[model samples]
Target: MNRSSARRPWHQHFETVGSITAIVVGVAALFVSFDQSRVMREEIRASIWPALQVDGFASLENGTLAIGLSVQNAGVGPALVERVTIRHDDSPVEDLDALRALMPPGADLSRTSLTGRVVAAGASVRPFELRYPAEESDDAIDVLNRLLSRWSAEVCYCSTLGQCWVASDDPGAPTMVDSCEGQPGGDF
Candidate 1:
């Protein structure tokens, strides 16, 4: 065979290198795409995140004693309240009426349902309110303080995006949950 025929073609070497480089680039592109998708999903969740807080308010002002329990939405998105579990001294209270029975008589009490309610961002829903004359403030304050000490609440809410969380009167951050199904106690 001739000398030129004995040597391998240079273009064949280039072709091999080109094929390997193409595969590496393709794999790198796939990883980048996956990361971008993960980031996008996180952004979507954050955009509709909802935070709920169970708050108690009491004040002796304007010759009136005002005491209230409310659920506030502090997040940027609306909170869809799914379930509410209210307890007194660690026992479940069946409904609003039962809760009201635990309060002192002679005070005007008003309440709104928390379950199946929608709380908008930066808005609050007063689930329970008690008003008494300032002349009764001293007695009301003592009773109210005792009542509050024995009261606790747990709220399960979802974001507009369907992300679920559980917030309670306990001290801690809200916990993420798969769903807000089958909570104990009657709906309030």
Candidate 2:
């Protein structure tokens, strides 16, 4: 046999090694990209988490003539209110009378008005007129504080991503917990 007819062993080994190295690098890059994508998605979800807080006590806004209860969205994103169910002493509060009964035992609530319903991020519903019973009270602030200390309300809200939860100021408030896995916050 002629010597020239034999294959070059060194060249063949070099080609094989180069091909294996290229394949390993490509696979590693693919895995890294997937990991990065997952991290990005998680971060996006966190940025838009929603949290709703219900301050059932009636209050007046600055330069406003009316007083009304408030709901605030204290999260990073806007909150869409699904339902607002209020209870006073475990009894459903459907009207102003029920709400007045739940107040500081001396609230009139005759001039009550619902100023706003939609709660934006870091924003509160407008104040509407809320009257209190003709009891010898020091001031409106004192009455509000007293009422807040003994208020009960439950609000269900959701985010743009359709994640939802139930929140309230009442102790041991229950959360709806629907499609909101590991959401940013709970009771506001």
Candidate 3:
């Protein structure tokens, strides 16, 4: 009932409640910020191509070396392969033929071109093929055989977002190894 004592209790209560509320808000904000940062990082990693697989071998027809690749999208978002770097037997080859002899005729690259979205998250196997204009000879066949037996192709893509993805398949596939995906890309 005394004025001083009554005011003291109210003041103490106010201070304790205010401090607790401030701490709770601060902790909540920190957790939210951390979660947002994690999500952003994950999104960046998903936008890039994660892996590549060789479905089969490339085919040799006329004077062209046809190759196949199975590109996969292992990101949280879609990806495309706009450019490619292929190698045969650990050596880089300029033309596709240097690695086509070992593949069957059906795996020709003449009609292979990545169009729509290939390889979605958890979706395996986006088959693709490649071709090069060059004659097939005995020596070339030997080279092709060796190359197809141990061939690999790296593919690059452009996304509307600001980033791209790359996927590769060792050896080859029945479809074009290079594909295109049109999706808004974001900076990683």
TM-score of each model, paired residue for residue: 0.84, 0.62, 0.44
Against the reference, the lDDT scores of all candidates come to 0.82, 0.59, 0.52
Q: Model 2, 112-173: lDDT tens per residue?
A: 22222446678876322355433343455765666555555566777777777877766543
Question: Residue by residue across 1-188, what tens digits does model 3's lDDT show?
Answer: 77875677554777787998999999999999999999997777656533434344555666666545555544444444455556656666554454454444444354344434344455554334555565545344565566556666666564445454454453332233233444222111
Error of 2 at 80 (Å): 0.9
TM-score of 1: 0.84
Considering lDDT, where higher is better, how would the candidates rank from best to worst? 1, 2, 3
Worst 10 residues of 1 by lDDT: 136-145
User: Which 10 consecutive positions of candidate 3 have the poorest summed lDDT?
Assistant: 179-188
lDDT of 3: 0.52
Q: Which candidate number would show the highest lDDT if scored against the true structure?
A: 1
Top-down TM-score ranking: 1, 2, 3
Better of 1 and 3 by lDDT: 1
Cα lDDT for residue 55, candidate 2:
64
Clashes of 1: 0
Candidate 1: where is the Cα deviation over 4 Å? 1-11, 136-144
After superposition, candidate 3 runs with Cα above 4 Å error: 1-16, 36-52, 58-67, 70-77, 95-147, 157-166, 170-188
